[model samples]
Target: PSLATLNIPTVWFNNPNVSYSKANLGEELLKFEIPRYTEWVRSTEAGSFHCDDTGLICEVKEAVTLTYYFDSWPKLLEEQNTEELHVAGPLLNFKVDAAEAVASICIPHFLCLEGEDSSHVYIAHFVEGEMRLEKPDRVEPHHAVLENPKFSSLGVVFKKWFKQKINTVVLLYHRLHLETPTFHLYLLPNDPSIIKVTRNLHLWYSRLPGSFA
Candidate 1:
């Protein structure tokens, strides 16, 4: 369908993972699977992680790696994005203390790369099931001409993540920022209900150490 009829915001998450690798759905799930068996980094609290903490951190690292593995491609893209896709709705409005960083990009990147050939656009898979969001209105073209040349022909719709029968919004990864890149997470603000559904469904995978039979 033309992007002009969806009643949901087009949350754009750019992953400049210089490797040019797009992750397969199975591979994406693997990144969430890795951390359970080891201590990759120092944890914020010295206690056991919540059920999905390991998965959350994996996504965090994937969000931070383009700078390192791709040799600072995300840095360059962020600089370009400052000009190229600014007209896009809900651009990466990262916080000063928390703009996208290398660490955040690594989690998701690793899930997609590892020892693979690593030569394709590393597109982040929008977990349609896990995102717990929906579009309730028709799509509309966004105007970004005054913002920047990078955003001239872009637009999106905004709605909410309906939060009902849901009492808490315990998203595993609150922030996924990467300076080497910009990892984004957007919501309709009204659909918190979908958030809980995805939260309840998130999972990680563990690869048995061996070549597949």
Candidate 2:
């Protein structure tokens, strides 16, 4: 078959939540659902669906949001060990007080999300920040919507309010960052804690020995 001339400069076939189940626990978790009695956003992806067609292509797709557990310190650290930090919430250096880490990172932090329907995660952010396509990661990062996300998405209040706060006391909260699918804007901790989430990731890597990095 002879290849015909394509219309647009690029032909993108986007199908949100393009299934890619393969050999691993991550793959299995793609279809896994968190057992919460409350509401939950669906897991999905953005596939070959592209606006390259030249017209306004509007379609409905699932959004990946997150809901955190252990809203407090003792609650969070209760289930965690040193090895579980990397896989938990965003990396932070919370050597101050375990409780401080919980208020800052978990209560008010941004973790990347994943699933099938995360093609243009930036699309949403661009519109919100009044930014353009150049800064996608700032808002809807693909890393978050990939699979078994390790971080959490910061809330709207935190985005607009506390973001510019210079002396805002922060916390660190990441137990077993196994991965859970949740969506929508989030909120930061309204209360103060005793820790600051700086670079807990270093300790995690250091424990990996002299070979992991």
Candidate 3:
């Protein structure tokens, strides 16, 4: 299907930088077995209406935490030729502070010939899942000709080049509960109903460990 027929925004279809192809699209859908435990995240405070369709209304008895773990890096990094191997954490920890949400990811970087230094902490804060970056942000020099935001994440930067072909939204880690981790994906249009449905249907892997697991 063409973007025009799908009612996709004009910018995605008409822009010279955009292109589409079905080569990357799959004909077969991957299937999953029913999970042993299903844990979901929903906020009635955010106006999520409760329905009795399931004949059970689950409420937060006490604060439950869930942790989501992404599979191992798609590929391993090149071996470091240093005398000592430096270790860094790629594990992401997400927590909500009061009403604000915060995420921290440990990124490994080399420091001169001194071997590996402490991993740098790349922090992204969100008032409501929209990423917050420090001031003095600039677009990459290669893309200066195109329009973009002043403060955008790496995910946002890549979108301009590939958005027409795919839907890429950055979701920050929220927490884990019942052997599953929750994530917060910023929604556009921010419709209350859509937001609730997204939250309700968001999947969690049952085999994964809980928060800090």
Please give the CA lDDT of all the candidate structures. 0.21, 0.22, 0.22
Q: For candidate 2, lDDT tens digit of each residue in 25-144?
A: 112321221121122222244322222111111122333332321122222233434231221112111111112112111112222333223232221111222322221233232122
Candidate 1, RMSD to the unseen true structure? 20.9
Number of backbone collisions per candidate, in order?
43, 46, 7
Instruction: Quote each prediction's TM-score.
Output: 0.17, 0.17, 0.18
Residues 87-116, candidate 3: write the lDDT tens digits. 111211223222221111112111121222
Indicate the residue-level lDDT of 194 in model 3. 20
Which consecutive 10 residues in model 1 have the weakest lDDT in total? 144-153
Better of 1 and 3 by lDDT: 3
lDDT of 1 by residue, 85-139 (tens): 1111221211112222222211111111123322221221122112112221211
lDDT of 3 at 62: 31
Mark the regions of model 3 whose C-alpha exceeds 4 Å error after superposition. 1-25, 33-105, 108-124, 134-213
What candidate 1 gets wrong by more than 4 Å, as runs, is 1-104, 109-115, 121-213
